[model samples]
Target: MTTKVLVAYGTTNGSTARIAETVAEVLDKEGLTAEALPARTVTSVWSYDAVVVGGALYTGRWHRDARRFVRRHREDLAARPVWLFSSGPLDPSASERDIPPVPGVVRAMARLDAQGHITFGGCLQEGARGRVARMILRSGKGGDFRDFARIEDWARTIAADLTADVRAGWL
Candidate 1:
């Protein structure tokens, strides 16, 4: 039987959606069947054998819908394999600095025993923010810092884990 994976994400300016698509592509290349969908559109988690939820961060928080999805489906998610990814931290100039993690989301993810979680740098459009948001973006030294190679590698690892679990009759 083919493994079914859902790559659900929430995006503001579309960077996180692209990242989710790329993750699905990587899983597809590894012979796993995956679908990339928006978090709001997914009504349930029962259909997928594994799930990967991702979203962009705004004001140091994840998209509300994404957080709600995890909270609502926590039990179902805990019963299966799940992974989480966050897209933010666009400070390429300070490569050594660590991006602060969102505590609420992190706590929710922990309940599901999430396979992994990652924070990727994101882009900020010139006029996409108000005065205060723009100042925050500027303070972060903005740039598109998404690393496709790293994203693909991470997806491959997820695929490998699922594959191994299936082979061992664990899934």
Candidate 2:
């Protein structure tokens, strides 16, 4: 049987969904059955062998829908392999480590003992931000900072992980 993976995400301005699509594409190319879907549409994570949850951060927090999805699936997620990714750091100077996901997201990952958690650069559209946020971004931190190569590499790692787990009968 094929290993199945779900790449669900909550995105603002569609950046994170693109990231999720890339992840799912890599997983499928690596021989896993995977699909990317919005977090709001994913009623549960129980059907998949593994789950990858991605979200965009705003105001030092993950999108509300992503948090709710994690919370709703907390029990099932705890029993299976789970990976988390956040796309948020717009500042090229800001390291991935400097951006933090909301506390609820952290708690969910901790509870699930998530296999991996990654952070990637995010993109912003014009007028997407409010006054204060725009001010902060205008300080030479604004632009499309997403790195597709890096994102693809991470997805490949996830593919390897899922493949190994399935082959070893760990799933």
Candidate 3:
């Protein structure tokens, strides 16, 4: 049987959406049925075997849509394999310290018992911020910090885990 996966995301400027798309592509390449969709638009995850939820960070919080999706579908998510990710932090070398992706993510994770959590660097668009905020961010040097290689590697790992679980009759 084919494993079905959903990569649902919420974003302010579309970067996180693109990331979710790439993750879905990677999972598809691994032979899993995967689709990337906006969290706000997803009505049900009942048909999927696994889910990946991600969102852009703003003032230490993930977008509201993602939070609500997790809340509304908590039971469904808890019964399946779930992974969580937060996209943000302008510094390329930034790690977990920079993520701190709001209390919402934490609550969602508790509700779902997510298998993993990742905090990835994100790009900052000058137009997305106020003038003063843009000036401060621009001062530190800016560029795309999203690591596609890392994202792909992680997706592949998830696919392997799903396959393994099925083989072991754990799925």
Model 2 Cα lDDT, one tens digit per residue, 1-171: 898899999986788999999999999999999999999999878789999999888888888878888888888888889999998887653344454556767887788899878788988867665675577567756678888888899999999988888789898
Error of 1 at 153 (Å): 0.6
Tell me the spans in candidate 2 whose CA falls farther than 4 Å from its real position.
93-102, 127-141
Q: Scored by Cα lDDT, where does model 2 land?
A: 0.84
TM-scores for all predictions: 0.88, 0.88, 0.88
- Listed per model in order, the count of residue pairs whose N, CA or C atoms clash below 3 Å is 0, 0, 0
Estimate every model's Cα lDDT from 0 to 1.
0.84, 0.84, 0.84
TM-score of 3: 0.88
List CA RMSD, all candidates.
Answer: 2.4, 2.3, 2.4
Residues 15-92, candidate 3: write the lDDT tens digits: 788889999999999989999999999999999999999998877888788888898889999999999888877777
| lDDT at residue 114 of model 2 (Cα atoms) | 92
